[model samples]
Target: MWLLFLLVAAVAAVFSCARVCRAAVAAARTGRPARPPAPAPAPDPAGDDGHAPGLTLYEMAYLSGGPQRLADVVLVLMAQKRRLLLAHTGWATVVEPVAQDPVERATLSAIGPDGQRPIPAVREALVADEAVRAVADKLVADGLALPAAARPGIRSGIRQVWAAALLVVLTAAAAYWMAPPGTDTALLLGWFSLPLVLCLGTLAVARFELHPYRDWATDEGEQRLPGKADPPGSRLPSAPLAPLTSLISLALHGPSALTDPALRAALHSSGA
Candidate 1:
């Protein structure tokens, strides 16, 4: 009966909205930053510790910005260091053949085998690169980031609600059209409205974190994200902010944090 179908749709919507709300709560739980730790002991000489004492620039970027932001951080730093040439017009050229780290190597590799590619192309390529994914995987392994499978996508969640709404509408229409004479189809329609009301209420109450932050870092991890930025009016060449340390600023504030006009223009245009 149409009433039954409406009830089923209502249940489906409730489940979907519940899932979305749970994700939002989980994100909120992880949204708090971890407290700063006491002084650390001497470093392990064999390079066996998983993550370094505090946090690496790569890890910081991953925590604050997710994969795409991490990639953008690397590209902007490389351009600042002159390891690569990134033009405001959206082209990238590899200036230095050697990469200092895995993340840099990944960026360079994403530029393609020929060492040249459009800035946007390279940005996209680097985001999906295995190397970048590896960084996210490591964070997840350390409990700093949510795993890919568990990441909450608000759009997808809303889509499920939409499907439920559609099902309810179709069922209600069918029940009305197929009713025998004097079957009281008006009452049937009113019953169906209950499920629709349920769906609408679920949507009204649900909440989720915005993208990237919720997509990546856990509460503990978010706590570790750097709160500093380059002091205003700071410029490059003198390296007012060390290049590696500066990645923190770039990660936190994005391309606008870069003191170099050309670097900001290039990466910003690349959709970083």
Candidate 2:
């Protein structure tokens, strides 16, 4: 029984650790120019649900900023339109008290019925909302995003691998305590070490190879983003695209993208 469990655990540890490393590697690669998109994968029925036609400002925001970027973009839109107020002190107040879309509604929801919340708090809260998840889903369906099973920029898997390593250690200790008096426990522990070694070794290698990766697009997505300024669904000339263009800037560059002083303060330094 103990032998069987050890064998299973060893295989489990190897696969789980491999996944984390692969995600890190994929993240590193995705930051570079996207290669030509491969043949379209099967469509996710729930994805690409007309969030706007192909790759709108919101989509680009998700591509560049992930979920948090979505929050920032909405805040930018709302603030620009004078529908919401963001203070340098990190607080948000609704000005219009109305939402224009599901994403905006989600932001308003995060701010609560009291109509105010910290910018960071709202940003964090919105990350887990259905609307944010939908943006990600659309990306995946469009071949721009890696699926959840294969999504990158995650630290949770690392923690899970560590937990698995701990389990192996504890199981080995328990096995040793239950073994017959004459049994050679060292050899048994050595067998268990196979999985532990794999887990720890992968983590150590990752420390050197990995950085904080926020990119979520495939090579094709990366390739198409360069020199791209038109927001999705709008065919207007760059002149007419000015407002959205600034949004694209905010989406791609971040709060610093704007020249506005107060917005820079609210999105940048978190103080009153």
Candidate 3:
């Protein structure tokens, strides 16, 4: 009975591992840039408010930095406007009852009705805020962000590798049980080493390939946003508006893209 179980488990492990390997490969292929560049999107007409209609600060942040970037921008704006005080310990305290803009208002709302909250909690709150949702919806509509369904499918495929690993363990256990008395259990476990190694290798490759796409933006957003220049006057050295452009730059290029060391430290400290 143990021998039959071992054989069946071995077969199952092989099948599951093969599926996982295929998924890893597919993910890697998707991670690569597509050939024959896509045409640039037509520019949206400017709104009377001086910004493009339907393009919110949240969307810009999402395109550049993902959700954390959005939170970082909000928190920075709040701190700059003196609406909130952020400490190196990850605590945020509200100093002003009013917000300067929609993004700032969303941050204040995420900090909750109370005057104080942990930075992480505030970030989580911002993710669920209406402004964030609106920006995400707009991005999805504009094809700048992937639909919500796309992310879950990729994540589910990645999770299957761990499930396959469990099957490998079961195969080993069954093999050990079927072995004769005094037989080396290590040799039975060794039968699984190849599958284990393959599974781990697939995971590593997937992680490397998928890291850039793990955020909200789709291929379209990734191709277009990074090349955009910082708006005039927004890049000035030691300017009060420096944080605003810095936040946008951080979104486009990553945390290291920030010109201001203090802003980078603040983002790191806030877990943004």
Candidate 4:
């Protein structure tokens, strides 16, 4: 029984590791770029029934500086007078009088076609207007209202976690099926999985670390390690030998060797 369990775990570990390794290789080649978030869709002011022509939720948000924009979107529900108050058109519509400062409320009022007033009514009117609806629809179709960029690291991290989990479950199951129940195979499988898991984790970390400041089209992650900047000129030695040469130069002369006349002359004449 133990032997069977270990065998199953081993098999699971192998497959999981293989899948993650392939993904890591692919990610390396692409030089992970941050994914751009899709823009929020404008709401249909014509209402949910589609009977009226109006702005969609997204369009209304844009005009009111409300939703759609990450900065403007509030997760918390706004309330007043111990009752939930919803914003209509662009104004806060409350059943009870607001106890909050009058000055603050006045400042938040929306300006509409008629004049400056509460926002809820104006928001509703625009959303219900046929022109707003058409514009909102067009905006979504044109793809002009993109939200924001999402970090590639996050996606990579998620993938890594998923891969690791799958590998663990498979390894455990394989070990159980392959080995006798009362054997040492479970321990063996556990030990084997440690190294495999570590390798996958390391690769995930490496990919994320290298993603930023990396030009995927040209430079691979391995080539862009610390101090891998291009040489300033041909006269300059290769990167690895650079520090030693600098030390030698400094030892022979001093820090001023960097600014020496002879060095400058040589550099200028070298076409570097």
Candidate 5:
């Protein structure tokens, strides 16, 4: 009877989980299917190219706790002439403008050398600049630009380990107080299997994005006019040398310098 009860509970749990996952995915994709892969130099309307050279970056943050912690992503793109920030709700028609900031004349003067060059062209030039590429490669190697999964896994894994340790204690206590014969072995099995189940379940239902980039806020704040005291704890979120060098090169030489087709395609897709 106990075995039958456990089996029925397991089946019910699996069915419930499946229903929840399906509903979530349906809600996310309710509008149109995702747009086709955006090509480099995305189709541009006439009269949109007279602005200064622009570099736009996006960042998204997410959390996992069953379905309750899921949040729609917000995207913020900042560039030389203007900034466009927006969020997409679950439905197709739910896009909303978060804010837009026009560049000041002084800032524009500082950024200088306007262009219609595509972003891919810039990425290519950066990669080809032996001096720049060497710095970027070193930054990537030193964990500044590596994928986000590695560090988060260590942090979240520690949380799971602590939770599992507590669950084992609770399960043992309950079994000792009231479970029937052979329940000790069952409790041991549960202790060993429970964390695996919880971790996989969290992952299955979580909103996951690969290679999430950190915010540039830290780096921006650290930059001084070459003679100021270094701000405390002000470190670039990325490998300090490469991102700074690249941005400086772009700022100085303009977007004509680098050209990476893949990067171009991605920025174009983003409408950056």
Candidate 6:
């Protein structure tokens, strides 16, 4: 009876691991390339508007650094425009009551009637915020961010791994119950080994396969806007409006790209 239970448990474990492995392999097979080709530049309509022809600052931030990055850019812009003050300790203070956009308004609301709050707390408050959601929806509609339906097959694989772990626990309990008094240690150890290996193996494979799909943009989004998806290098704009353009680049690429050392120092001092 003990041997039968052990065999059944081993089969169950193998089946669960196999399911996860297959999902992982499938995700890899359909995964996006590490470096997709640059897309042809689209013509820009002449304007001083912060948004480019095909992409907005929010979209660029999403492509490069996700929602949190978008939030960071909003905060940076607010500080640069002298509408907000950021302390080195991560607290933010509203200096201006006005907001330039919905995202800006949402960010201000997150800071609350107190007129000041920690950056992390503000970020948390904005996670489910309607204004943030509106920005994300626009990005998706504009082909800059991935739609929810197109995400990688991670949920099922995760469920399988948990199920396999439960099976391992149940198998161990059965083994203990069926073992005779003063059973040899080696026999018990051998009985548990297969299920343990299967559980660990499933988790490892899930992590490997699901890692690449963790980005905010999907394979389709990456392919469509390859240039915008990466950190700006030689691709940085040099027009008369370079200062405004650079802000977009900084939002996507990060503060290190700022030409103004003083501005960079100020941004870094905020501890963002």
lDDT of 2 by residue, 1-272 (tens): 56866876787788779778777776545444344423433333211222223455666667766787778888878888788998888889999877767888998999999998898889888889999898777667656765565553346667767877887787777777777788778898889998999989877776554422325555545444433344432332256545555566676666666657888788886521
Error of 3 at 160 (Å): 2.8
lDDT on C-alpha atoms for all candidate structures: 0.67, 0.69, 0.63, 0.36, 0.29, 0.65
Clash statistics: count for each candidate: 3, 3, 1, 46, 13, 0
Query: lDDT per residue, candidate 4, 147-250, as tens digits?
Result: 11222433444455566556656666665567655667647667656746754565566466534312111132223122223232223344665433332232
Q: Which regions of candidate 5 deviate over 4 angstroms?
A: 1-16, 27-173, 181-272
Model 4 RMSD in angstroms: 22.4
Model 6, range 69-114, lDDT digits (tens) per residue? 6777777777777889876667889999788777888989999999
Ten-residue region with minimum lDDT total, candidate 5: 64-73
Per-residue lDDT of model 3, residues 1-272, tens digit only: 44565566556556656665564455444434444333433442111112323345556668766677777767766676677887767788899978655667778777877889988888888877887777766666666665565565567766777777677777777677777888767766666666777666767876876543456666665554535455432433345545555555555555566665655665667666
- In model 2, where do residues sit more than 4 Å from their true spots? 1-53, 152-214, 226-242
- Give me the candidate number with maximum lDDT: 2
CA error at residue 139 for candidate 4, angstroms: 20
* TM-score between model 5 and native: 0.26
lDDT of 1: 0.67
Candidate 3: where are CA atoms >4 Å away? 1-57, 63-65, 94-100, 112-117, 173-205, 225-245, 252-272
Alpha-carbon TM-score of each model against the true structure = 0.66, 0.57, 0.60, 0.27, 0.26, 0.58
The whole-model C-alpha lDDT of candidate 6 against the native structure comes to 0.65
The positional error of residue 185 in candidate 6, measured at the CA in angstroms, is 19
Instruction: Write down the TM-score for model 3.
Output: 0.60
- lDDT score of residue 60 within candidate 3: 62
Q: After superposition, which runs of candidate 6 have C-alpha atoms over 4 Å from their true positions?
A: 1-53, 140-212, 226-232, 238-246, 253-272
